[model samples]
Target: MIERVLAIRHDKIGDFVLYWPALFLLKSALPKASIEVFVAPAVQALAEACPYVDHVIVDTGDDKATSQKFIERNYDAVIVSCSEFRIYKMIRHLDSAYKLAPKHNWYQHLYKHTADAQYKQGEACWRGGCMLVEHFLTQHGIDIPELPQQYWDLSAERQKWRSYYGQEGNEKLIFIHAGTGGSSGSLSPSDFANLSTNISDKTQVDCKFVLTYSGAEEELAQQIFDQLSKKSIKVVMAKPLSSLADFAKSIVAADMFIAGSTGPLHLAGLHNIPTVGFYAGRRSAPIVRWQTLSHSDRRLSYTPPIGKRTGKNMSLIDFNAVEKDVVAYLDANYA
Candidate 1:
């Protein structure tokens, strides 16, 4: 009956966010099933906030403790959303009837079944996770539907955040996140400053730029903040929150989000917020491959030219074109 299912994706925050769509499909397809998630400690808070999840098990990197947690649960199915050898060793001993993962590496054989969820040139990474879940359901004689769009009902949190920040009702909130998390190269401070200025000048609607940052990237964000302040733009640094979940709640109020491919950018995607992302031109991390988990109409991306010399080079992207397109999008939708 597949009464209990454990979906594992103990990876980076951004990748975990992308896996939400697949998680959505799983819960929708099997509503009666108790769906739990195993995630890294850093992602535990956000995982708990997910509407589709019933329980969240945080991987504390203590092998014996983690193994005990899994053994006690005795899941009916284990879907390794992001396959890893370490993960294989953790769950292989479980007596689950079905253990599914992508057809990758020799380690994949540890799972009871494998699906062709291999990454492709132009497919969103989430689709591979979707395929794995879909294959699992089909094998058990379950019918699944097309992927549905997702939204969060964060009205209370949004209102509290807006009130706390003194966000004016008339101003459109645009969050500009300058941190790249080192996953991909990002635009320079000057590029972000110019783009923010272009947006302010071109969009008819009143806009408030919120500069979001974490850790040592405070310098990067401050650089953009300073440049925009000199131009007399309405910009402020996003207030620090207690946790990643709280930060995500704050993002629910944003009318638009802009960042290089990073965790915060994907957190904005959780609300289906209109997102504009700067991506690496490399094949593995192209705009299409790591696209935010928003509806197609809500996402806009830019990247450098594709090649060894330019693929990961942020300077090679056309900031002018990006600025124009972003301004146009804001005018058409929000204005």
Candidate 2:
């Protein structure tokens, strides 16, 4: 009788988004249970927006206070989706009957249940997360069903942002984020500008582009804006929003999203919106490993070759080939 369950994934925005399916499956297995999550302060708003989560506790980086808060709740089960040594230290004190985590650290023996998130070359990060949850449930004599593609009903958020952005006459809105957030390799402003121009010129669909950025990325976004302006493409800079949750709401208005493997791209995945991602050509960060959480048919990805000169080089990814495939994707889906 796991009536109260707590899951912890206090980490990056992209990783949090990828872990949704695991949470979804957990809720499905224990429908009547009260499911809550502990998250990083940076993703508090986004975590609150998750339909699968009932409550979100923001880790203020104070281990004592945060642990005390959860300790009062007396959760029956705890699932550490993204395990950290710090997390283990705090939750180890929790009197929960069942605690599950991956078999990663030496301290993993602290967990009552530990499962191997069988690491393999070029596998999606979320697959391992799902394995952890499935393993925990099966050990408890609960049957786990196959996961369906996930989507959020953000219609109100969509309507609110679409009203603000103001689409004219059935134009398909495309949001392009040029900065990499220092997470992986990405294209130059010139490359993004040229690709946008090619899509506008070649695709049969009537498309409007919104250049999105925050912090230091403003310069990168502006450069692409200027280039597209000179090329006569229908483009505009996205209005700055107050928070990540607000930005995610704006993404709901977009028909498509494009970026390097980064936070904003995964925000679009929350809606299962069509996505185009540029991934680093490393074995650990392959196109498949970091693919957007969108469904298979909704995502298209590109990466440079895996080698010394090419692996981290975004310039080596053939943008011309990318442009052709993007144009074809747009025409097929939008036209």
Candidate 3:
């Protein structure tokens, strides 16, 4: 009987959110056990907010200190989701009977058992990584379910956010983020405004647009807002979110979210809000890899043509296609 477990994936936002399903599996497989997570300092609050995790340890920059925290946890199982060699070495003496990770470089030999899968064109990071976690459970005679049983009970937050936003029953709320064009390119400010205007023009339902952006991207966000304001349709700049938690709370009130394959898009996906993600058509950041990890039926992902991989051509992605699909989603859900 596993009484305690340790999961390590000290990484960035998109990287961190990818592990939610695996964490779900762990909590479900051993319902009575305590699940502890080691994540980066920046995401400590996000990890803490997850329903599955009982305790969160922020990664200490000091190696000895990090190892001490791991040893202190008395975990019966360990799951390594990060590829850092430092992480592997820190857990070298994990007293756990089970250790699982993906089969990778010679470093993978460190794990007692490894999941057999390669990160390739056909495989998504979340699915491939979850395979490692799944293999560990199956070996121990635990059944892997067809779908992940994980979602935050954000109903209370949603209600409060709804009241806070003063959302009436009629209008469809859409949140948009146009940043770094999925980190591989840039979608011009004019294009963002055009898409916003098109959504309003195409949708029969009354629409509201919230241009969400971080501190650094305020100017870009403002530029999009300025462009949209010039149109007859209404667009508003989102109030500064005090923290990631704040942004997450606000997402609960959204009808649809649109973004390049950026961090906030993943944040909204975690909430299972409908999302439309724009992705680059590069092998390293393929549509399959960076697609918003949401409920399959709730997301629409668009990638440029095979030859149009460069950032300069991101505008070539059809606004008509985006508007049509988004309006369709709005029609189905809200109309």
Candidate 4:
């Protein structure tokens, strides 16, 4: 059995969130093994706080230093969750007896003599057997009883929200998250302004709209906040949270969440909160993925059906379509 494991996944928040199952499995299988995680600086704080990890190393963008640090660790096993290329390179530098990596096209270069296993990411089993996280564990001869939708305790986070809004649990709270990373077309400030204004005008509920995002999207967040202010929509911006637990608590305390396929959506799923997820494209994958793991959420994609096949183009999803679904979901679940 492996005695020490070095897990590497230096990527986004969602990437880290998806791997929580795998981390739990590794710890359960090798109870005495020391587990160290390697992640980007942005995610280092979360990794350090993970209950399953023994140590967390931040990637400083120095290949030589990183390689030397790995070499010095002398781990008995290295499980690279990021990708095939990183696994291959890291294996060559380590004195590990086993290397585990997800299956990909680049597997041809892996050493034949070393103990290796093929893992499939995002695989779902009908008996709840296979999933991206379980596949990794099964490859390592470990079986997990259940895949937990991971969450962090946000009692403090709840307090933050309450203090910021002066909310006494009497007023209805609606959180609108418009910050999605990468190339996804996030809701424009004007769109949020219109939606919040329309909701307040049409409904007589004592509602408050809060906008949340990582500081990276500050400019866009500010624009949305400004637009909502002019319409007299009670808007609050979430300051940078110190931990995922804080973030999860804030989401759980909210009455309703309307956001993109980002971290907040996953948080809502974990907390069993009623959520409306807005996707740029109309494919059912996001909904299917979330629904398989959660019970109290709805997904709305922009892509429309054409003939026998669904359109792949995401541009077809309009602002009106998003607003309609949001309103419908709030009416059905929140009302």
Residue-level lDDT of model 1, residues 1-335, one tens digit each, is 77889999988988888888788888988899889999999999989988889999998888788888988998999998878898888887888888898898899776669999876777877788888888988998988867766656676677777666567968888998888863556788888899899889988879999988888778988999999999999999876788988888888888899998468878887888899998888766667777787788989888899888998888889888887888888889878
| Per-residue C-alpha lDDT of model 3 across residues 217-318, encoded as one tens digit per residue | 789889998888877667778777687767776788777888874677777877888888777766466566766667779878776665644533777787
**Which ranges of candidate 4 are over 4 A from the true structure?**
28-32, 84-87, 111-136, 139-141, 153-157, 201-205, 214-216, 241-252, 261-264, 267-272, 282-335
Better of 3 and 4 by TM-score: 3
Separately for all candidates shown, the number of backbone clashes (residues 3 or more apart, or on different chains) is 0, 0, 0, 2
lDDT of each prediction vs. the true structure?
0.84, 0.85, 0.77, 0.62
Among these predictions, the greatest TM-score belongs to 2
Models ranked on lDDT: 2, 1, 3, 4
RMSD of each: 1.7, 1.6, 2.2, 4.7
Residue 15 displacement in candidate 3 (angstroms):
1.5
For model 2, residues 143-175, the per-residue Cα lDDT tens digits are 997776655778767766776776777788889
Which 10 consecutive residues of model 4 have the lowest summed lDDT? 124-133
Model 1: how far residue 57 lies from native, Å:
1.2
Report the C-alpha displacement of residue 70, candidate 1, in angstroms.
1.3
lDDT of 4 at 193: 69
Of the candidates numbered 1 and 3, which has the greater lDDT value? Answer: 1
lDDT per residue for candidate 4 within 1-335, as digits (tens), equals 76778887888765665556567767766778888888888777768766778988888877678888888888887766665565467557677776655544556347433222332234321112124335545666776655455444455566566666556545667777778742233566666668678876665456787777776666767887898787777877767576765665567567777765456666665555566654434343443343322443444434334322434333344656666666676667556
Q: Which scores greater on lDDT, model 3 or model 4?
A: 3
Alpha-carbon TM-score of each model against the true structure? 0.94, 0.95, 0.92, 0.75
